[model samples]
Target: MKYFVTVQATQADYEAMEGTESPGPPRWSREELLAMVNFMGELNNELAASGELLDAQGFTAPAEARFVTASPGTEPVITDRPYAAADVQPAGYWLLECVDLDRVTEIAARITQCPTPPGSPEHPVVIRPIGEAPAP
Candidate 1:
């Protein structure tokens, strides 16, 4: 089965990370961020070694959107749409092909334990198995 792991952060957490001056806390130091990246890469390498990694990547933030409403007789109104008014936002994701759900969960757990950069807050990594398609 294939799985997708999504990482999300709260707004406060995101803000706290924004001005980090070093990897430890003041700001995310280059080394700290690199360490995190290295850890992720190591995880990918381990998955590959186990013949489970299919594909993975860190994603850029999504574009902003506005919700608009229009009346039958009036122009539409526009309003910014927030994700549940939560401070957290999705930061990255990973995709993996595993033999079973247990394997996927294990990998996600390992990732959760990896260290985060100073400015970067630890976000929950969501793991969900991908659905299989019906035969054509």
Candidate 2:
């Protein structure tokens, strides 16, 4: 089965990773950021070698996101802002083909262990199975 796994982070977290000064969370050092990049690279390589990684991508800041809504017989309302306020937003995702839910869950567990600042709050990792369309 194919699964979509999401990793979330707060705006402060993103800023910290970029070596920017934020209000609350401490900023990350150059070495710390490099460590995270290396970890992700290793993980991606491992998954690709195992033939489980279907696709993976990281998104830009939430401020760059756009939301759209429409009503009947009306033009769509498109805005560059988020539709709802959120403390945590999806920072990246991985689409993986796994043997079962257990396998996917294990992968997500590993993601939760990714390197981060000491005492950083743990963000939830969402994993959902992809549904298949009926045969055409």
Name the top lDDT candidate. Answer: 2
How well is each residue in 41-122 modelled by candidate 1, as lDDT tens digits?
A: 8888888888887777764433354578998999999987665324566666777888888888887888887777534555
Task: Assess candidate 2 and give its lDDT.
Answer: 0.85
Q: Tell me the spans in candidate 2 whose CA falls farther than 4 Å from its real position.
A: 82-86
* Candidates' C-alpha lDDT: 0.68, 0.85
In terms of lDDT, model 1 sits at: 0.68
Residue 120 local lDDT, model 1? 50
Measured against the true structure, the TM-scores of the candidates, in listed sequence, are 0.66, 0.91
Backbone collisions counted per model: 12, 0
**Which residue pairs overlap in candidate 2's backbone?**
none
Error of 2 at 26 (Å): 2.0
